[model samples]
Target: MDASLEPRLDFVTCASPAGLHRMAYWEWGDPANDRVLLCVHGLTRTGRDFDTLARRLAGRYRVVCPDVVGRGRSDWLVNPAFYTVPQYVSDMVTLIARLRPGSLAWVGTSMGGLIGMALSGAGAFAKAMLAMRPHAGMLPPDQGIRLDKLVLNDVGPRLENGALSRIGQYVGDSSEFASFQDAVAAMRANSQTFGPHTDAQWADLAKYLYPEQGGKWVKHYDVAISQALSSQTAEELAAGEQILWRSYDAIDCPVLIVRGAQSDLLTRATVDEMLKRNPRARAHEVAGVGHAPTLIADDQVNPVADFLLA
Candidate 1:
């Protein structure tokens, strides 16, 4: 742990229905600090994905970045089929129990956002939630809401298939990146947050990717995550979306929704409809990006940090 960053780094494991898996998380700032920040990454992303953001906020809050089960150093699920929001939520709940105090400030991206929403709706985690490019709705009976100060990053009810496929290049296969710089270049090119990455940021993600047999780099997540996506049938996907929609209606915490202007995942109509029901909700679009906005660059980090800290 860097002495400058107050919170010490600790590794812990949680035994969920899936099995026992190690979750390596970085806890920065002062351990005694009551202001806790939980930063979760998108699907196929590891907890280390938040290194830059965690480092930036270390001075003010106890930042916790957990490697969601099946990603990074976390153990793979006994049943790959359990690699959904519900399972992730179970593991997170366990993590929260060990963390104690039961409440936190959340920063979730993509799948992580959905998990946060589930926890909030169930009244089990976090005092405030900031979902970056979050997936809308968790259960069918519930309608999506617009809460004051919520940031929804470039994600909505519907997504553009082509753009989704394009974004897949970065998250799915790290083999394309010969070095960490290549990965950073790919992220900057497709990322909504526009800025250059420092050496530290690049080094952070570098430790998360490993070289495979072919000398190609691969993310440190279970391939089962990808298999989960491909194995889903259209009907099953729709059912899952309905479940999430109902759950979204139940979240009562302060929310911020930030959308990427060019994101194909979050549809305009969905945003409009969300605003219609939850008039309290606010939306912002990041220009010149698509699918998702990685919270690495200053532009992205500042907005998220401000929202959570506020």
Candidate 2:
């Protein structure tokens, strides 16, 4: 089966204090299949980042990849402040309601992994806070779907300040390129941490990174997403880290932590702590990668598939 041919575009309306916005998604495989796998992209990426992985998994699961709000084809938030994890989590809750799957699995890279950790590990108080929102009325009657398996790609509760600072420096840079090749070169330079990919793979990845507009190739996401990172102070990040640890501990499902061997974002110390906290959590280190491991390669995707299928 042609995975590209199998995917269909769809949208879900999600609510925010600023109002409602449409979140776009790509669905692959049998829509009727109750076993669902959700693949969410990194901080600056769109849903299309998972095209290769989604295609491979489509035969066994209904794969859904959403362009998180303010990225890809998803509508930008009326309030840039709403680009934080809480809002992302709320939007995902809305999406899950629409999918209504019997069993759910998650693959989250970078910021996406943070969102998954929030949803999968939220405690009673966190759930109550989410439910108290005005849009809570729109959530599924069961609240939200529980994850059966979770793949967190190069992110953990504890983050390296230096790595975050480096990411923050470039997260909002939206330079225009004269040609597609130029854009590809820029992406390759900035994303060397995503590890090595062939010239063909980099070309494929560039398609989603740059969207042509008015005859110029521009970055695919809304620039305001950077505000979410810029507004976070060190103290706030520390507090947030505490919250993430609580949530990570609350998770009952099997967890897979995909760490790029050279990652500066998720440190070996943090991975060790995570495993200590959750006995069910295991680590898979992708050699040569830095901040993240894009699940485009068979070596990266196979371990994830085996974990989910096991």
Candidate 3:
């Protein structure tokens, strides 16, 4: 495929406690298209994770995938403590202001999904408040951009501690690879939770996972991001759950919950609970997967496309 025809890289300025930073994004399709689809990656993943999905949806919507702060090409926070959902939510709102689409939809994977839920629910208000303070006069008047649709990929309000622990076990363990192939091998081993993929697909994924510097390869993201997860106590997690559930219940947009049938993070019981609380929400479980479905495969992408384009 011609690289020129692929998504264009861009960046937007966002504010944090450490000061100002730039958040990088990749945009596909017509820039003037009012229909916007924002695809966010998982905790340690980059916007490139959505390459396949973005290509499939570009003709229908203006697809934008952002590398969250502390990850991908985005700036690493001076204070790793700022690597929390609230900060991420703030950065997204800034990105939305820059996009200024007529309508917006979201496709979020794992940590990305949590940000979506917050934006769709009471979390929007949190962002609004954040914009008003500190960054006052930087954002335009609230345009009331409704979150038209949402696709939560293998994540919900309730998170399994065991799964989180498993993720933390390797998140910040950055390493230099002897070669590109070795990096791909490491990525495949650590991301087995992303389910199966062909060698070609894994190679494509690895390209974005690591970037070469000083004649060697290194993980693309800032390792400090793992600090937020590692320091969380049980009480803090429970409190966070209450906040997230409130946000979930407050959401009014149509939500499509895509679950990996074998996922350890989001369970069937949680999906059931999510459905009960939100009349507009539904679930579609993908077989043979574990923590997440990358939406790279046709079967996985089809249902999401149907929901968004419907």
CA lDDT, every prediction? 0.61, 0.86, 0.86
lDDT of 1 by residue, 1-310 (tens): 3645433456677654446767777677777776677778777677777777788877777778888878776777777766766566656666666676334777777777777666555432211111311432122112222222234455543444555565555554534656656655554455533234466754554557553435655557776666666665666556555555544555566666767666567766777766665645566666665556777777777878787767
Over 213-292, each residue of candidate 3 has an lDDT whose tens digit, in order, gives: 88778899998888889998998788677767877887889999999999999999999999999999999999999898
lDDT of 2 by residue, 89-151 (tens): 889988998999999999999999988988886553265445444443322222334899999
Off by over 4 Å in 1: 1-8, 16-18, 123-152, 156-207, 211-216
TM-score of each: 0.76, 0.94, 0.92
Evaluate residue 194 in candidate 3 and report its C-alpha lDDT on the 0 to 100 scale: 77
Give the TM-score comparing model 3 with the true structure, all chains together.
0.92
Q: lDDT, candidate 2, residue 189?
A: 91
lDDT score for residue 216 of model 3: 77
* Stronger candidate by lDDT (1 vs 2): 2
Winner by TM-score = 2
- The C-alpha stretches of model 2 lying farther than 4 A from their native spots are 3-6, 124-144
The TM-score obtained by model 2 is 0.94
